[model samples]
Target: MEQDWTAVGDALRARLDELGMTMTDLATKSGVSLTTVRELVHVLNTRRRQPRTLASLSAALGWPGEHLGSVLRGRPTSEPSGFGSLASVHSELQDLRQRVEALERAVRRTD
Candidate 1:
């Protein structure tokens, strides 16, 4: 079955919103370019087929990279291994740390 890119983008956007993040924030966190992040968020046709890009985004989003890649490639992903929430918590913590660091940087700059 063909993968629905629109659905993929919608899901990703929803996840970002749930995490209180923007596409630029996701790009910075995932080490993906802003353009690529924008394209992915908007479901625009772009050359975002690189495995590393997908892997980076998945890792940043706290999703299984392999499963995300499979879905992006229009392949079947296996059932969850029951660690979804744990991973999400971990990701949230990481995001918080990053946010703290950014705030610290801003404070130092003002000093």
Candidate 2:
């Protein structure tokens, strides 16, 4: 395929046109740089936009809350903050498996 820019960049570009705005217009309205706007379009076109790009695009478009996640970032949505947590302290998931089996056995005996 010719890398369907339609699904991404073209769509955004169309929206901008419909709103009577160029990339320059968006940059002017949002107080962002033209270079940043171009980079956002490029990345989104290539399916490489990051969270930071979405944030910038969102702010520029005045999108709030969960906007620009799937549209610009190619994901279902995003968290307001990172959700990663440290895995169990000194307790690998694999290590817990055997221990859990043993505990289950003990509980069964007591029942």
Name the best candidate (by lDDT): 1
For each candidate in turn, the TM-score is 0.74, 0.43
Model 1 alpha-carbon drift over 4 Å, by segment: 1-3, 46-48, 79-82, 102-111
In candidate 1, list every pair of residues with a backbone clash.
none
Tens-digit lDDT track of model 2 for 37-107: 77555643354445565555555554443355555434454434422121122223434686799999999
Provide backbone clash counts, one per model: 0, 0
Q: Mark the 10 consecutive residues where model 1 has the least summed lDDT.
A: 1-10
For model 2, give the RMSD to the true fold.
Answer: 18.9
Residue 109: error of model 2 in Å? 94
